[model samples]
Target: MKKRSSVLTLFLSVIMMLSLLSACAGNGNNAPDATNSGNKGSSNSGSELKKDTITALLPPVSANYQARFTDMEKEFNALYPHLTLKIEPASWEDMTQKLDTQVNAGSPPDIAWVGSTGISKYAALNVLIDLNAALSDEVKADYDEVAMKYFQLGNSQYGLPAYLAIHSIGGNKQFLEKAGIDWKNVQQNGWTYDQFRDAISKGVVKNDKGETTQYGFVFATSGVTSKDYLGIMAKSAGLPDYFDKNLKFSYTSKNFLGLLEAIRQMIDDGSMPKELSSIDAGKRWNMFLTGQTMITGKGLASFENSARLNNEKIKANDGSAVADSIEAEYIALPTPTFNGADYIPTAVVDGYIALRGKKDPSEEHIKNIGLAINFLSSGSIAANYSNELFLSPITESARNAAVLEQYPRNEENVKADQIMMSKAVPARTDIPTDLAAEALKIETEVIVPKLQALLANEISPQKMYDAVKAAAIKSFGEDGIVVD
Candidate 1:
């Protein structure tokens, strides 16, 4: 991870650059105009571009993802009538595996939107093309160089970043205020672990029978998985990730023990769901949206708009299944800092990458592929994707075109999200392949299940720590883990 100061400087410059670009564009209130595609610096003319069917693997960007993709295809086809797009939908969890399978079968998709972590993995496999060389300088120059730097391996640029994503918590302001807590203040000034625990515990409400009508907190293994959220909690609270800032394996530190203890304490106090271990991400989100939970873990900024849309549906009553709709206000909050540690939310840069595939695409095919990629990942199209997720647009043209069109945004939520972005360090992409692979193994095979057991109250924090340490030692050897 870069120094906090360096990260802040880069984010600030990105903001300044976006402001200048938007000011120059002069259409501040306009929605993204997908029809005006010719002006966005594509050197490929209609006559020069080759006609071919390009298949793409796309992850779900919203609940109405089918409609979103349909709209995208329409816009893209309108822009390039010669190119045909065959988009395949896949969940984020399954995309990497599906892509790998297709690539190994000697028939990979022409394009896939992948997370930052997958770039290095795929680049190592020699499956991706270098966007840095294929894309025009005008399009390339608009992106924040630091963000683009994450996708580069030596001289080969693996992909073009779509947006910078921050994963944090979302809260129901009504519940917090009912508990006499000022959530706006918490959004501006982050809370400590102890304060967060106290606030949530206080926020828990009971019915006349003393049953938990509203849970203070809830989490599931979707979006930000438990391992990532727990890891980020430890990191923001001054502990190291699986690897420390020095880039050495260091998950067994005492601070890690503290993180486990803090989580268990919340569970014991009845502030969080006791059956949290069994709940999936969909259930957790529904629980929060329907007012059964006061706060949700691993909340993405995009969910703020989801809550708004849900409320709108409830008002319209135009749907068949509007029984569970909620009208509550929501805001995103940074994962609480511990002691005096800096607020750093877990973050990643998502990208649109083109693959060479086994089809052995010709030079013109590759050029056409690059042109399609540039269109999907820049200007209005990229802005639309970013708007769906409420992420900061990485490309200047996207920034200029971005507007809050789909859903109403909470100003407080936007402000809090921006603050978290200023502090977030995109997960380090430079780990040695062998060590990185081992770390991933340890995470899935050991850390996640053990942490789940801890959340389920099946094991004490000490026992969970001990078990994880033993597994880490077995995988990484003593020299790799932090002895302290």
Candidate 2:
């Protein structure tokens, strides 16, 4: 869920093609059909709800936020003719700062998109409205309980989970078959680290000159720091969370050494390229999509959407698209586990939150804002957003309306995605702000630079762990880290 600028660019490019395809397909307005818009809140009757305007801040769900939000607004207006909804598109990177500025100036938007981690912070600021008091029980009941928990603090519900983002390993089907691995089995279940190494090593091809003709795997590097890269993989190794609420830092623990060894072994055997530390994600992704590599780490569901978009362009003979688009399917698999470790993909949940504006509003206005939030966050409208973004719907209504046929999707990949989501757990969202900031500083300033040396094979994993531990202790004090 930590999206890079390049990924956003890719998403925008895909959205352009999606618009063209959907236009040709004639799926009018981009909102679910009235017959299919299951569980949208009851329409306002007679003069029960008075006319009011509510403003919202949302990120671009598609290429054009205006177009998408306009369609949603139209759909919402049909049910609540009296309420006028105005949506402002904000980039994910700038949303928090922008929202803070507005809230400080006593003019926060009625509703906005916020990371689940930020809900508690905003709730503490007294800027958030308790959603439990706002949304109807019928609507709230439809949301997945796991996702809903992120919005709850004590008795107040601060937000509604917008979507589920899962990160997993992706494989090329032809390469898996050539390597004598059953793609279906890998996709359905998962592989152990040893199995992963053996399979990828088998897939490697070398020329007569001893140069690798094709790599077995590629690691995505751009937009990821060393802490994130290792922390996510550590879960598959049955390691505890590296940083916990109790301020215990476990990155130096002995168990973590196994994860480092797995990566080094992968590289030492030539299953992964030595240049992994040098290349950015763009290069690695191109390698995977063009079949230069058989597998990729840090894979996203969005890649499938990208592949579909590329294929659509090829089918349409669009000169703007990549010529050698992926023909064989790209499928996702759960991360390779270590020991008897359970496979759990890293997940981040983002949600919609209603804010208390500068001035106390009338109850009717608050009611209107609640209705607007529910309209955008639940039911078929929410499903449409999830479909476009390749996100898991958090509401039962959205889930029921999530028909893959609505867009370009590989059924196998979709199945694998669902499996990953079922087992996925959210990142720690309750970390205190100051401590979180301190942890981030250590990650970027201390851990990442040494990680580069580790990736380049210039330092042993033990040395890398030791160096980071020393630096962390110096900053956090010896008593802070979990030495075990």
User: By TM-score, who's the top model here?
Assistant: 1
**Against the true structure, whose lDDT is highest?**
1
lDDT of 2 by residue, 151-225 (tens): 766667777777777767777878888889987898887888888888889879898999996888887654432
Give Cα-based local distance difference scores for all models. Answer: 0.74, 0.72
Q: By summed lDDT, which 10 consecutive residues of candidate 2 come out lowest?
A: 28-37
lDDT of 1 by residue, 1-484 (tens): 4799899999999999999986765542222222233234333344444467777888876555545677667667666666677789998677778888998887888888887666656665677877554566666787788688667766767667777787788888888888887888888888888788888888788999999988888877533465665766776766635687665677777767877888888888999878877777778888887788888877888888778777778788888323575787787887887746677777767777879775567755665566666676777777777878878788778888845466667888889988888877754656765666677777778889888888888999999889888888887778778866
How much is 61 displaced in model 1, in angstroms? Answer: 1.1
Q: How close is every model to the real structure, measured as TM-score?
A: 0.82, 0.74
Superposition TM-score, candidate 2 onto the true structure = 0.74
Q: Report the lDDT of model 2 for residue 366.
A: 65
Candidate 1 lowest-lDDT run of ten = 29-38
